[model samples]
Target: MLDRRRLLGLAAALTLGACATGPSIHADYDRSVDFSSFHTFSLASDTPQPGAPPLTWQRVSDAINRTLQARGFTRSDTPDFAVGFTLGKRDRIETWNYGPYYAGWGQWGGGPWGPSQTQVRTITEGTLTIDVFDAKTRRPVWSGTATQRLSGPVSQAEIDAAVTSVLAKFPPGSTQ
Candidate 1:
């Protein structure tokens, strides 16, 4: 059970959480100083929709690739690294029907009411995951995930923002 007043206060806070950024990259530069060093890169996604939006997929993917390239990750036959993401919605009932009370003229009715308090909740969630591996060893070296709200049918700009925010936490020089 949650406190009524407290929950109301947290509504805005949770909404803002959707805008929260991803992790941070503080490790040394990865072993792969250049894109070629890793092998190849590909994006693996299970995004809610199939068809890409106007400039949304292209823009977001390109930006993600660029970010990886800048970080020294390369592109190849079998990408040594893979990028994946997901988006979804969850119902959150912010408010509900409370007692029909007047605070007068009622013996059994606590507040002269007829009904009790009831509410439903709805929320949306989005997630991004990045996987890095060693081509030679055929093993994943590291991976990261960032989850938040869709807020809406996110635009290309929004996707970029989300991806950028998440990748910003990639570890530096992650490879051994």
Candidate 2:
């Protein structure tokens, strides 16, 4: 039997679950370093994943460039920091089942009454990771990651938005 408290708890859980969203963002950096000292940046000469379309690289570079430039950072041959990024995807399977089945008591004692339904779904999750390294130290100074469910082809707007969100905390500590 479902009591009043149990019913209320179930309703709250369902409501919260329904409101859940994907495409989370996270960032971290070395606290000991002074971000303001870094003024210029240049893209690293790392090769894109084999077989990746050239357009994808172009889009990412353009998006990062736009964000950094907007933040008053200049791109130069000899920069204080270097920027690089990686993209990846993975498969995930999710399944859900309908409510419990109720047995109906008739002349035949007890039998299955309510229909039971179940469903399984496959989802592809995409991740974008950006790394910033100090050119002199050749070590990572800052990094950010964004994860989200992927559907169909990725759009330029989506890429731009994700990059912007990840870089929103750029330069860490000090407000700039």
Candidate 3:
């Protein structure tokens, strides 16, 4: 027996789950290079999208630095690899149509076949791409990217989560 409260809760949970999807993460590295040989890294540069907030960019940089350091990679003026990143965002509109059966029972006086209901929401999607370049060769050795929906103002925790997800498979082989 599905009571009103339970049914409503289930509906809300499903809706939220559909709206908040996990970040899409992708990473690749050059197999010819010896990843273990690289022990030091330095921030080379960052290209944030036009009109992007500087504070958000800083948070991302800080998160990447922390993640790399935790993985036993040291920061140095003369590094074996130089790290760079780019940030981008775009607006997206999502529409969901619950055809003829939303909130079918209650004081609202709708039967099992209620009128169609549609939901439209505007959201911001953000993408972060990190690149690692061989300092000597000045060529890209590794790259990772993460794309996800941004809810409200960006926070350090959010940035950390995204960075962590993106870099989860760095250095070609070692599991971290």
Candidate 4:
């Protein structure tokens, strides 16, 4: 029974460690407009929010650009729509665990034994936002964001993934 608890604890730790500041922004797009026309990009706002130290910005932009290029977008002087984004994270701590103790299967009421420690975890948090705008009109058009708990130091790879996941939703044509 103790072995099971240890296994459960270890699995939970792996999940926590693998987790970033928030859920990955899955790139979903409106199949209305054609994405090929998209050219040129611009910053919506230079405003920066207080986020996970600095791992925030690099994570968002790099991911967006990479995703766009992968889908066949080129950096041009003039383009279809304007792109603007902001990155930030916040220090979030909850009374939630921060630590977990497993008493084993038998220890829990579920098992055929005694009581077990309640499973809980306090998660730190962070958020990222990307705002897209109409280039010709210079008005905000589409935007996407992602927020997650701050488990630990975020690497460039994770940031890129989060950004990629979110921007994948960028509207191309627009049926809606």
Q: Which 10 successive residues of model 4 have the least lDDT summed?
A: 9-18
Model 3 lDDT tens row, 37-115: 8999998875543444556667778898999999999999899999898776566899999877565656366455667
Clashes of 3: 0
Candidate that beats the other on lDDT, 1 or 4, i.e. the better one: 4
lDDT of each candidate versus the true structure: 0.50, 0.73, 0.74, 0.53
Off by over 4 Å in 1: 1-57, 72-115, 172-176
TM-score, per-candidate, Cα-based? 0.50, 0.76, 0.71, 0.57
The best-first sequence of candidates by lDDT reads 3, 2, 4, 1
Q: Which tens-of-lDDT digit does each residue in 1-176 have in candidate 2? A: 34754443332222111112546889999988888899999998546544344566677778999999998999999999999987766668999877334334342545455667678998766677889999999899999988776665566777787788788879896363
- Across residues 64-127, which tens digit of lDDT does each residue of candidate 4 receive? 7677777666755676776666544444444432223343444554543433434444554455
Give the candidate number with the greatest TM-score: 2
Cα deviation of 58, candidate 4, in Å:
4.2
Clash counts per candidate, in order, are 23, 0, 0, 23
CA RMSD (A), model 3: 12.0
Best by lDDT: 3
Better-scoring candidate (TM-score), 2 or 4: 2
Off by over 4 Å in 3: 1-21, 46-50, 95-121
Question: What 10-residue stretch in candidate 3 is worst by lDDT?
Answer: 10-19
Model 4: residue 19 alpha-carbon error in angstroms: 0.7
